[model samples]
Target chain A: MKKLILLSLIILSVFCSCSIKTPEEYYKEKEKGKYTATISINCETAVKYKNSKRKKSEILNNYKVSYNKGDTVFTALKNACKANKIQFEYTGAGDSVYIEGIDYLYEFDCGKHSGWEYSVNGVFPSVGCNAYKLKNGDVIKWLYTCDLGKDIGAVK
Target chain B: MFKNFNPIALFIYFVYVLFISVFSFNPIILTAGILGAVFYCLFTLEKKSVFKLFGFCAFMFLIITLTNPLFSHNGRTVLFFINDNRVTFEALVYGAVLGLAVIEVLIWFKCFSTIFDSERIIFLFGKISPKTALVLSMTLRFIPNFVSNFKSINTTQRLIGSDSRIKRYLNSFSAVITQSLENSVITSDSMKSRGYGLKGRTFYSRFRFSTRDIVFIIISTVLFALSIIGRTDFVFYPSIDAPSLSGFSIIGCFSFSALSLIPFIYELKEGIRWKYSISKI
Candidate 1:
C-alpha cells in the first residue's frame, strides 16, 4: 500500500510537469481611447471547404475597439484580435500589411481564388489594409471569399 | 551489408531514401525515415556513437519545434499567446516536421559516408569524369585526415605543456591547415606524374554487379516509385488536419518503411544466416 501510494504520487508529479501551462494574458487593456471603430470578420464562403478551420460563418462579430489617431484598419483588426485572443496573421509591414490568415483560415486555402478581403463602410478600398486609415466610428468588415472577392460582393 | 551489395546499388538506395526524406512533409514518412536512419546507423556505426548522434538530433528536433511558433503565427488552433503573438499548434507541427526532415537527411549522410569509402566513390564517379572523381575522393579523404592530424598535434602540444586551451586549438588548427595544403600539392603532383585523367585510362575496381544486386536494385526502384506516387499532401498553415490516407498513400507509407529498412533487414538476415551456418558446423 505504501509503495502504491508513492508510485501514484510520482506519476501525478510527472503528469503535472508534462501538462501544458496555461498561457498568461498577452495584451493589456488600453487605458484611454482617442477613437473607436467597429469591426467584424466572417468566413461564410469557407463553408464550401470540407475541412476548414472555421467553426462558424462568423469568426468575430461586430466588436468595438478603441485606437489612436492615424491607426489603419489593419491596426484596428490587430488590436481587436489581441484583446479578444483571436488568432490573426499577416505579412508585409506598415501600409503594405496584408492579412494572410485569420482564425486559422489562410489565403488560397479553399482554392486558388480564395482569400481574405476587407471593406470600410461597404467600400472595398483599392489599397492594402494597413494603408486604409480608420476614421472615428468607421465600420470595417472582413470577408473570406472563395472566388477572389467576387463571392464576397467586393469588385476586382 | 556493404560487402553484400555493389557500390551502385548502395548509391541508388541512398539517393532514393534521401529524395523521399527531403520532399515529403507527412508525419508518417518522416517517422519512418527517422526509424530507418536510426536502425541503419546502429548497423553501420558503433552503438554508443549512434545513441549520441540520435540524442543530439532529438535535442535539435525539440528546439526547432518549440522555437518555430515564436516567429511565425499562422495557425488556427491557438495554444497560447506570447507577447501578443499567437503560438498556433500548426506552426509547431510544421517546425517539428521540418526539423525531422533535416535530421533525417543528416543521418542518411552519415550513413552515406560510412557506406561510400574512397574506393566506392571513385568506382561510382570514375566512369563519368576521372578528374572530378579524384577531386571528390581526395576531398572526402582530407576531412577525417585533417581532424586526426589536429588531434595528434593538440595532444603533442598538451604533452609539451603548451599555452592556454584556446591557444592549443588555434595552433593545432593552423598546423593542420598548412599540412593539408602541402599534402594536396604533393597529391596533385603525384597524380600528374602517374598520367591520370588521360584518355582510355583503365581503372581497377572490385565492385561487380551480381544477381543479388539486381534483385536489391529492382526492389528499391519499385519501392521508390510507389512512395512518389502515393506521397502525402499535408497542409500545415491556418490549421492542422489529419493526413488523408488514401489507398495509394497507405501503400506508399508501407513501401517507404520497407525502403528505409532495407539495409537493416539485409544486415540482420546476413547475421542470422552466419549464425545458422556456424551452428551447423
Candidate 2:
C-alpha cells in the first residue's frame, strides 16, 4: 500500500513538471502596415515601326511602367518615369535619361539635351542622373530613340 | 504485503500499465507504469525466474537497439561512430525506450496470466459457453504440453534409426502433428459423448459478486470509460507534441488500477489463511 502510494506520487510529480502555457499569451506580438500606389509605362511608335530615326512621339506611342522605389535621386527619377508610364532607351555617354521608343533625350551635362532637372531631397547624389526618389509631385521624362522592346507584360 | 496483493487488482493494474504505456506518450506516465509493473513482478514472482526474465529482456533490448539504427535514421543528436557511420543519439534512446516499454508491457501481461489462470477463467467466463471455456482452457494447457511432447519425440527419433538431423526432425514433426490431431479428435468425441454443449449449460464458479467485486467492477468500468473517452475525444494526434499527463490524471489512473486488484487480494489472503489453518493441524 505504501509502495503504491509512493508510485502514484512519483507519477503525479512527473506529469506536473510539464508546464504548458495558454494560447492567449502568444497573441500579444505582431506588426502593422498599409497599401501603396501602382506605376505604369508608355512608348512611341517610330521605334515600333523599325524606324531608328523618327519623331520621338511617333515611334513610342503606348504607355507602360514598372513600379520601383529606393533612397536616391536616380531611384526617384526612375520611379517617376515609371509612374508616368514613360519608357527609357539608352541615352548617349555620361549621365542622361532617354524616352525609350521616342528618340528624345534628357541629359544632365547642360551642354547637350536639357529639361527640368533637380536633386531628389537635395541629398544623396544621382548615378547617371537617373537615381532619384519620388516626392508628392515629380514628372520624370524618358525621351530617347531605340526600340521600347517588348512591354514584357504587366505584373498582376 | 501478500494479503494486499490481489489477483483481480493485479490484473487491473496490468491492464492500466499496458494502456498507459501504449496510448500515452507522456514519458512520466509510461515510467510510472513501468515502475509499477517492475514492483509487482518483484513482489510476486520467484526471485530466480524474475532474474532470468530480466536477463532475457536485457538481451532483447540490446538486440533491438543495435539493430534499430540500421533501419531507422531519424532525430538530431549524434552519439558515436560505427564504421564511419554516425548513429544518432535519439534513435538509440528511442530504441531503448521502446524496448523497455515492451518489457514492461510483457511483465504486466505475465502478471495477468498468472492471476487469471484456468480456474479464474472458469469462474469469470464460465457462463458464456462450456464448450468455448473448455476449448480455451485446453488450448492454454496444450501449448506447453505440445512443446514438451515435440521435444521428447525428436529425441526418441534421433536415438532410433533416423539417419540425419533433418530427417529426424521431420519425422518428429510429423509424429507430433499426427498425435495432436488424434488427441483433438478423441477429446471432441468425448466432449460430445458427455453432452458438453447440449441445451442450456449450467456453470459452476467459486466467484460471487461480493461487495468488493461490485465496487471493483464499478470503479473499473468508470476508469475504462474515462480512458476510452479521454483517448478518442480529448487526446490530440502527433501525441509526441501533445502534453498528455497531469497530476490528477495520473492519480486517477493509479487509483483505478489499484481498486481493480481488490478481489485478487481477497483471494490471496483467503489462500494464505487456509494454508495457515491447514498447517496448524
Best by DockQ: 1
Candidate 1, residue B122: lDDT: 87
Each candidate's interface RMSD, rounded to one decimal? 5.5, 24.0
Please name the candidate that would achieve the greatest lDDT relative to the true structure: 1
B138-197, model 1: which lDDT tens digit per residue? 988888899899989999999999979999889999999999999999998998899888
How far off is residue B212 in model 1, in Å? Answer: 1.2
What DockQ does candidate 2 have relative to the true complex?
0.01
| TM-score between candidate 2 and the true structure | 0.50
- Expressed as tens digits, the lDDT of each residue in B55-132 for candidate 2 is 887898798877765444343343443322334555666666667667767776666665667776555445667767
Clashes of 2: 51
Models 1 onward score TM values of 0.79, 0.50
Please identify model 2 stretches exceeding 4 Å from their true place.
A1-156, B1-17, B46-48, B80-86, B129-131, B157-163, B218-246, B249-281
lDDT of 2 at B255: 52
Which residue segments of model 1 deviate by more than 4 Å? A1-32, A38-64, A69-73, A83-85, A91-99, A107-156
